[model samples]
Target: MQNEKDIVIKELNAFLQGQYMGIRAYEHLIAKLEDPEIKKEFQSMQQDHRLHAAMVSERIQTLGGMPVNNEGLTGKIQGFISQMMMPESTENIIKMAIKGEDLYGIQLSEEIVKGDLDPESKNMVESIIDTDRRHLDYLKNLVH
Candidate 1:
């Protein structure tokens, strides 16, 4: 059974992994999509995820946990899975990314609200979640 500290570490790692996963999705979409404007937009979002990943990594280290590098095996699998179907249109890619961002935002928001994180960590996470919300809103606006 995981204690409070263990749960915190686990959630931190999961958030880190999700950021990596998101970055990979952006990179893949940028490469696969033919539209220049859409690709550029996704590139910007990828940079945001990189920043979030670094912050999460720092928090993991502060908690005396080894941050998983390269986004874990699940991240790798997800990258491969996205590659398998390869969306044909940039619009489709944006829709898929918005869906991912929505899910990611919901997951982290719910976890943070559970009140498991320390005050400082919770504040940091809330900031990151805010960024995700911005990304999702931007993607939706871009597509519509």
Candidate 2:
């Protein structure tokens, strides 16, 4: 039987892994993109994911939990797919980015609504969720 703190740690670690996955996805996109402006925007978003990963790692450590160092199997599979089948058009790239961000935003929102995290962790997640919304909005704008 897992206690609340342990469950929270597990959830946080999962979120951290998701951040790493986002970073990798952005990297794959940036490498494949031909446009300098879009690549720059993706790089910025990737940096934001890095910052989010750092914050989540710090909170996990503060809770006496070990942070995951890698993105795990799902990330690898997603990376593989991105490398093999990513679209060539700028609009398609932006749409893909928006989809990823939207999914992440939904995941983060679900975590908040779950009420499983401690106050500090919840606050950090809320901050990340706000940034995710901005990312989604930016990508959506690029598609319009």
Candidate 3:
């Protein structure tokens, strides 16, 4: 059987990866946005994602695991084009990101429960899910 340390390490790595993904998504959105207020919010969200990644990385270190480098490429193309022209693609991209986040949250939660993860690790994942939900609502409000 895997040790508790291993389980926590795995979960922390997963959470860190998720945070990295969020940071990339928000960075893309901010680059595409023109409105000052919306851009500010996106920037703030980006900072939050950085914090989340740091926290998860710390936890992973405590659990004796090497944090995995992110390999995200979801928003690169759309973000670059939107950066040049403030198009109406932000809403769709944000919506798709939210959907992806929700699906990821569900899967992570299930994994936490089923795997040998600790309670603290599970709680951290849930907290990240909550934050993602808030971000989704904020983006949806902007769209509508």
Best by TM-score: 2
Off by over 4 Å in 3: 72-88, 104-114
Candidate 2 lDDT tens digits, 3-116: 988888998888888888899889878877899988998999999999999999998998989999878898788778767878888888888788788885556555643768
Each prediction's Cα lDDT score?
Answer: 0.81, 0.84, 0.66
Instruction: List runs of model 2 lying over 4 Å from the truth.
Output: 112-115
Question: All candidates: CA RMSD in angstroms?
Answer: 2.0, 1.6, 4.2
Candidate 1, residues 1-144: lDDT per residue as tens digits? 878777788778877888888888888888887878777878888999999889989988988888877768977987798789778887888888888788765565557546678777778888888888888989899888
**Candidate 3: RMSD over Cα atoms?**
4.2
For candidate 1, the lDDT comes to 0.81
- Which pairs in model 3 have colliding backbones? none
- Best lDDT goes to which candidate? 2
lDDT of model 2 at position 31:
79
For candidate 3, write residues 12-74 as lDDT tens digits.
Answer: 676666677667756666666667887787788778778778877776776778887672354
TM-score head-to-head 1 vs 3, winner: 1
Q: Residue 89's C-alpha lDDT in candidate 2?
A: 84
Prediction 2 TM-score vs. true: 0.92
Model 2 lDDT at residue 116: 86
